[model samples]
Target: MNRETLVLPVLAGLLTSALAGCGGSDDSGPGGGTIVVGTTDRIEATADAPAPLDPAQAYDTASWAVMHNAFQTLMRLPRAGSQPVPDAAESCGFQDNHSEQYRCTLRRGLTFADGRELTSRDVKFSLDRVRRIAHRGGPATLLSSIDKVETPNEREVVIHLSAPDATFPSKLTTPAAAILDSHDYDPKALRKGFEVAGSGPYTVRTEVDGDRLTKAVFTRNDAYRGELEPRSDTVEMRFFDDSAALERALADGEVDVANREFSAEQIDKLEAGRVAGVRVTESPGQAIRYLAFNTKAPAVREKAVRQAIARLVDRQALVRDVYKRTGDPLYSLVPTGIAAHTNSFHNTYGEPSVAGARDVLRDAGVRTPVKLTLTYTTDHYGPATAKEFTALRDQLNASGLFTARTQGVRWTRFRQDAADGEYAVYGMGWFLDFPDPDNYIAPFIGKDNFLNSPYRNRAIEDDLLPRTRQKAQRALAAPEFRRIQDLVAEDVPVLPLWQQKQYVVAREDITGTEYALDSSAMLQLWELGRGAEG
Candidate 1:
């Protein structure tokens, strides 16, 4: 349950082999089989769905899972492994002046499902559309590095960086950089729900109401040339409301694989060999859960209150009780496996003790019996979140320095309230949109941060990030990232709680399941087939 298990030693070194087996088999159909996958809700393929498919608009990990199926970028860092590979543009290597500008030439004849010719214009259109829509909740941060995108011709796209960006091409490998067909996209039309319009292996064929979604089988587009080749003609995704339902479906043989939304208890049951014929694979997840204080609130605006709470709760107990050994206690926002993720907080704070909590409050000239309302989401993360918050409430109360009242709400509503600055303090979880130091910093440290946390660290925003983004070499990314971690520890705006490992369980017929730095790592649909026993 410690933090050392998560950070990638060298970011690029790991990316080299990340998605090795994610590419699907070349065989046409599943012969006579169907791979049923389980999720928490039904997917409606409209622009307005809870998880939309528009690459420019998606920010949530769940949405990106669907979006990636429809769109592709010049290059992609596969979900299972650590390396960057060409997905759409054939091959991508930086052109001259490796500093502020890079140009990539497209492979000929790649086309959208609707037969729109894929070219440099398409890439430009995707980037431009993201900039134009500029959804406050979308992938605007990913596009923050680009100063401008120029398509001089149909085949060539040149991206001018705002600073020296060594990771620009790698950024493009994510779904955030997925190219869309501008010809069919309507900027004026703000359609919500799921809709597909790109060149991935599968197309959104239909959605049956009541939480079950069926995707019309994938057929190789004559122009499609990515590494993945679909084996099943069609894939059906059944969505449930919770882990219990999803697990039940898996046991009942209603689904062939579990994509996401399983509780730690469910994973344990599967791991204990309780579910026969099911093969389980585990990976260190690049996800972190933390307590984010809303600095905009008057009481939490005090560092004493924030630090006191951080000292009151025990991270190891929290992981063991709530996460069921599926999580590692976090000492830094950048989890252990990522490059430059140092245990700066643990180095500073040590461990949770009542004396430490009292000292922080006393030093800030705050008297005992500090009362605050702590909020948590019931639906988000898992069923254990409420119990986790209750534990936090008890721990703080037991410290005798603070009295905490707890509140719980569904995830969607909780997010709306958190964004509106309604809570004094709340439990939060962050699964990276892309695995980078910027992803760790930019969202939580800026003036307009994601958590409604107005915790602005000028060092991260003005100095560390700008300096780090300019270098192309991965080795150079470490020092700057470490500096940001130190600053994050000092500010204490968000208390790093724990980093969770993601687990996937499937019938033994499946193989090649693994974790990706970006939380969307289980590429079971690819390289999964019936085993010899089957």
Candidate 2:
């Protein structure tokens, strides 16, 4: 279908809502204090860091948390909303009727932390470098649709796409699309250093007290020309080894605000007012946990086997028994709050049934006691993962139709082995890059997806996604997204497990916990501050 006939009307209608959603209000707080944010996430030097802070090279959530404050993208998401608004760019929209050409105009008087003029050329260079370097497991895959970049002048940048993608603007809101100073970074390779240069709300300075990174200090950027205004003059982010250490720091007054890594027990205690001086804030999280099946594996390659295994999964049991009802039972890749969410898995598999599962295996001429190996990470996901896997094994073994063996691997090695197709079935979790339903679907099922599994559906990759992208209003694409969810349920490549609930704990003196979480579930450093007494 031609882009003009299919995509232009929707694009036109979307711009108004996009503009309205992009507006952000300044946060209200007592202000004038150094906010110390504590997290269990490790921030290491190049020698021990999981990934560098370079915008083109960093893809993990930990790195993005710091990079989001240090660097600026052409479009930025507001602290309270998901819609992309102009950041470094004064304004942006489709320049052609086809919706394949997008243009952005640089804001006047924008400069990087290094005092270099920020222009369209830097925007073009930043995008081109991500695709050129294409680091493994990096977010360059987010920009795979861009055919080329055109600079009409110093102020305007035009991005030409090979296909129409309504979600392209949302991609630019990610840290991967962060614009860099052309004069500071070499275009040929990834930037080599702990420091970064960009036009954002804050400029970061890294401190290493020992072998590990001790702290990251973020000072308000005077040159920033964006919608967000820093409530605190400076933010000091400290990294801890685990949730216990992080919680202790908050109780001991070592840290003012704590970001994530709280166990369910700790959360319950804090919620019940057991903690002396801390309060917990809860929000609907965009993260999901699932089980991925390697289609190339001999035992799981059979469609009937996968379907039978799907029937054996009890999401309610997993949530109640394992998660302690801390999260909601998820039945599709698209979480509940998002548009086009359906209970496809429940519709397809019904409740957990031993007889039905056994019949499915018998119909396929498979023997009883089917052997399946389940792999998961012990250190990364949480302490609950081990118990979760154990529960899964007990559930499957109780049916007498399958014998499940569990294996534990560290996160880094597990990710590599999963990509290599070394395991038959594995546990995985997804944190959203953007709040759109497309973010939930495209990244897991699209070509060369993050899963690295061999499963592929031509209808999902080629037809449904492209057609959905043609719609200007995201809600209008509900039918297509629902249909895609049904297809995923039928295929059984990845089974939706559960969706997380976000919990942020802060001291009584700390304000702005209500606005701390952005649309992507990342903490907004600019929203936090201290009370008058603090």
Best by TM-score: 2
Clashing pairs in 2: none
Taking every candidate in turn, the Cα RMSD to the unseen true structure, in Å, is 5.0, 6.9
Scored by lDDT, the top model is 2
Cα deviation at 489, candidate 1, in Å, is 1.0
The lDDT, on a scale of 0 to 1, for candidate 1 is 0.65
**lDDT of candidate 2 over 1-534, digit per residue (tens):** 000000000011001111000001233233646778776654443432234677666665666777888888899777567788888889999877667999999889888877788888999999998988876566777889899999999999999999988888988987779998888787868766577777898899987655455688888888888778777767778878777887787677777666645667777777898767766667666577888899989979988888888999888999898878777899998889888899999999899999989889899898878899999876555568888999998889999988999999965566668778899998877777777788778777765677767889999998998889887688899999999999999999998898877666666766665556566654467776666524
lDDT of 1 by residue, 260-349 (tens): 556677778888988776666676766677887887687678888787777777989988887777778998888887777898788778
Model 2 scores what on Cα lDDT?
0.74
In model 1, the Cα lDDT at residue 330 comes to 90
Off by over 4 Å in 1: 1-32, 41-51, 78-81, 96-98, 208-223, 514-524, 532-534
- Compared with the true structure, all predictions reach lDDT values of 0.65, 0.74
Give TM-scores for every candidate, taking all chains together and pairing residue i with residue i: 0.88, 0.91
Please list the residue runs of candidate 2 whose C-alpha ends up more than 4 Å from where it truly belongs after superposition. Answer: 1-30, 43-50, 208-214, 532-534
